[model samples]
Target: MSRLYGDPIEVWTRDGEPSQFVWRDRLYLVRRVLDHWVVAREWWKVREGDPGERQFWRVEASPGREAGSYELRFDTASGGWLLMRAWD
Candidate 1:
């Protein structure tokens, strides 16, 4: 278990894949890999074209630190997942 922004967060993996996590009444995927792990928050952002903003984390499980991830921007206006790169 870890705490972020004063919120209690619990993380567990199954077969190295980010299987379960909870934050602010929301469920997240924390995928774990041989080289790294990932955390994703599918949130709605904007109202029209973009869904708005999302939170993502690329974790380096080997080194035990965040490897940097990205915020997914959904164009609610466009009604689709932005085809942008993870780091873009």
Candidate 2:
């Protein structure tokens, strides 16, 4: 798994699910959504003014070639997205 810490991205969602994303100037289309879940921040661990409630989608995506699995995250607090991790 390759970690992409807080890398901002642009996502296209369909029916509230992430269908594709633009990252690092490339577009990756999601082929399959393997899993989905939500992670609520622990109040004790959260600092003041920090974002919380991350929604994660584990999916198989392709950039016009062989598909790869990746974990994409949506920060509910900030309404932003991130490419969290990838399995090549």
RMSD of each: 13.7, 2.9
Query: TM-scores for all candidates?
Result: 0.28, 0.84
Candidate 2 structure quality by residue, lDDT tens digits, 1-88: 5756668889999999999999889999999899999998888866577757899999999889899988899987788999888887
Question: Highest lDDT: which candidate?
Answer: 2
lDDT of 1: 0.36
| After superposition, candidate 1 runs with Cα above 4 Å error | 1-6, 31-88
Worst 10 residues of 1 by lDDT: 79-88
lDDT of 1 by residue, 1-88 (tens): 3322423445555763344454446554533432332233355533554434443334323212333232222222432322122221
* Predictions in order: lDDT: 0.36, 0.88
Residue 2 CA displacement from its true place in model 2, Å: 3.8
Q: Could you tell me the lDDT of residue 43 within candidate 2?
A: 85
